[model samples]
Target: MFVKICSKSELPEGGVFRFDPETAEKAIVVCNEGGEYYAIGDKCSHGNWSLAEGLLENCHLECVLHGSSFNLKTGWPDKRPATKPVKVFTVKVEGDDILVDIESGVLLEKPDA
Candidate 1:
């Protein structure tokens, strides 16, 4: 099922929002890149750092601790220090609401451990 995380107005262009659902095990990071919405796992694949605390340039989110940049569209890390990709979730904008399908999260690469 899709959950309403925030309104479109709340997240301006090139903005990021972190949502932690009480029912979920991991938090989600919602990003607005040039008016497009993308959702991915909040934690950095290489470290326990929060992706929301990192920088967003183009469609990639860079981890502040290790400088590992992950593509928001595919969840694959483009920079080094990170081998595994983070989970990506389906995002949909309905009217003024931004919804995320937490149940449909997919990890592009499996973790080694």
Candidate 2:
């Protein structure tokens, strides 16, 4: 099933919302870059820092903690100190609402934290 994380208006034109599910500390970030919206795991592979607090550009997410950049579309770490990828979710836009499917793992996932 898909989870209704947030509405389109709740996010800024180029901002991200850090989501931490109550059921599990498994967090993710819902990003809105202009009209393109995406969801990715909040955790950074390099460290415990969350990607939601980073900057977004060209569909890439930059980790502020260590300057590691990740492709927001694929969650693939593009820069150093982070060779692994983070989890990515399937995002859908429906009538100003953004939906996320955590099961797809389009962003990837770590089996053992």
Candidate 3:
């Protein structure tokens, strides 16, 4: 199932928006690169830093703490210091509301292109 995160207007081009659910166990970071949207795990795999607070360059999101860059599409570490891949969430835009599916209880696999 998808949860409403925020409005589409709130996320601009090359912008990052952190979405928190009712529980503190999970958080999602959504990125607006151009007109498309991509959602990924908010926390960095290698550090305690939030990826949403990091720099966004194209599809790569750089963690300021360790300077690790993760691909928004696949959640793979494109740079050093991060060998493990983060979770990539599915995003859906419904009119003005932006929804995200955590894909919880699902098996880890290659992201869809």
Cα lDDT listed for each candidate: 0.89, 0.80, 0.81
Error of 3 at 22 (Å): 4.6
lDDT of 3 by residue, 1-113 (tens): 89888898899888899987754347788998878898888878888778888878978888989898988877888767887788888889999988898764122464554
Clashing pairs in 1: none
Candidate 3 deviant stretches above 4 angstroms: 22-25, 104-113
lDDT of 2 by residue, 26-62 (tens): 7888898777888888888889888887898888888
* 1-113 per-residue lDDT for model 1 (tens digits): 89999999989998999999862348999999998999999988887888899889989999999899989988999878997899999999999999999888898764333
lDDT at 39, model 2: 84
Q: How accurate is candidate 1 locally (lDDT)?
A: 0.89
Best candidate (score: lDDT): 1
Scored by TM-score, the top model is 1
Clashes of each: 0, 3, 0
Runs in model 2 deviating more than 4 A are 23-25, 107-113
